[model samples]
Target: MKDNRYSLTGYHKETNEELWLWDDLPELDMEIGYKVGALLHYEQSPFQEISMIETKAFGRMLVLDGTPQVTAKDGFIYNEMITHVAMATHPKPTKVAMIGGGDCGPAREALKYKDVQQIDVVEIDPRVIEVCRTWMTQETDYDRDGRIHTVIKDGYKWIQEQKNQYDVLLVDRSDPYGPAISLYKRPFYQYVYDSLTDDGIAVFQSGSPYYNSDILKKTIGSVKKLFPIVHTYLCSIPSFPGGIWSFTIASKKWDPLKADLNGLQWQEAKYITPEVFRASFILPGYIRSKLEEK
Candidate 1:
């Protein structure tokens, strides 16, 4: 896997772990795909890494087989959407916590809202952080910001050790499966509830609604049991299945949609306009009913 190409020849005999035939295939077939050098999946049809066909569309986005996979060249659309939504809603989220946002995109987006004075990003993998900094080199240098701090550790475990303080907490984690299993535990959600101020809110990336409906629904149900108000939003990502992805908002006191956008600050963004905000809330009938509120 010298240049990010691998094939699943078979699983380990006793471990049952996936065994891949790693070879340097950076150009032809492009057998593997990585977000920011972090392997997402091999043979994942929805996304493919195409070498030499980089996108000049955004800035220098890597268009994997014609699909926008990770950091868009022009902007951080998904990151802005996720962070700004919560920041706009909460009256003044002064102190914030972000779990697993190694890309630094979410931190960049959050810092724009001037009210957020301090942000603590708790990430598990030092390698992911190193890769993103070395590869993407997003403008928000993790090394310089006074408002932004890093606590390299297990997010769930760290959350359990906190007090009732944060105004908003964003879980910018990977999917709720595999290495991120602890993120979906009921106890972890409870800790998130406990770590927030009375009016604090938490936003998280749930998963693709089409493929993981059960997991998505269960997470909402569990969060609803913890926070009095919970709402889910959808965003479109070409790499993810169903074109639309699920995000859940949990708060002890706040409505994400009723948030006042004017109160928040944003430098500039390619997506996530006021109109986009309104449209994002209008979910399908089935999804609305599933949440038990319209």
Candidate 2:
């Protein structure tokens, strides 16, 4: 029953039609596969290997370093959860800075608020943006929106040069690996702290609690040391390893639980609603135990 035409990394060297792509999670000794209709694009950028594949289930998918980053169908779940939770929690977020959201999902969600004046998207790999623009136009075609300023630079380096600048800081980068490893450390969290306004808020995609508990623990633990208030929230993203994913929100003053949605204009959002936002922070008993673990 083994399929010789599909490799763990990519389509087999022998054939191209009806291929399978697997995201290998070595930590858990598991891998997830998608039935690909076609390998739309593939290339080795200066930073990493980027690919766009047409999947039978998810429509189109953006893969980085042989892992699926986002898909055309359920990508809104991650993007909306990450962006809206913090944006809604804050009183009035005008200036925002997003690190490593090259696919522009978080940026697109952030743009829905009329109060947001500017958004700076710092991505290390230009090809991520390029590939997303070309193949995933529905998600990445917001470049024409004047409020967004795409900065092709390293996020860790870029944030270090700023001070008291952004009202909201969104760390939407990849998992802790390669160039992004630094972004999940204490020093980078300090930089995030410094880059935010007095009452600013910051949020990070901390990965799945079931599989990536250490990452969630580290993100919450690290940010807790710096910010007066920190909370871990969960959302469901069908394309991710575990359908359930975690996000950490850190604040200088505002309480995310006390988010005011009466005046906010976000009717366009498909995933996040008032009830869902309130319920997202209500972690399960095991997750609470996971956060409490040493």
lDDT of each structure?
Answer: 0.68, 0.86
Best by TM-score: 2
In order of appearance, the predictions have TM-scores of 0.76, 0.94
Error of 1 at 258 (Å): 2.2
Question: Total backbone clashes of model 2?
Answer: 0
Model 2's lDDT to the true fold?
Answer: 0.86
Question: Candidate 1: TM-score?
Answer: 0.76
lDDT of 2 by residue, 103-164 (tens): 89889888888799999999999999989988885643496789999999999999999899
lDDT tens per residue, model 1, 36-75: 3333332322222322122223333322333333555533
**RMSD in order of candidates:** 8.3, 2.2
Off by over 4 Å in 1: 1-69, 73-75, 140-142, 289-294
Worst 10 residues of 1 by lDDT: 44-53
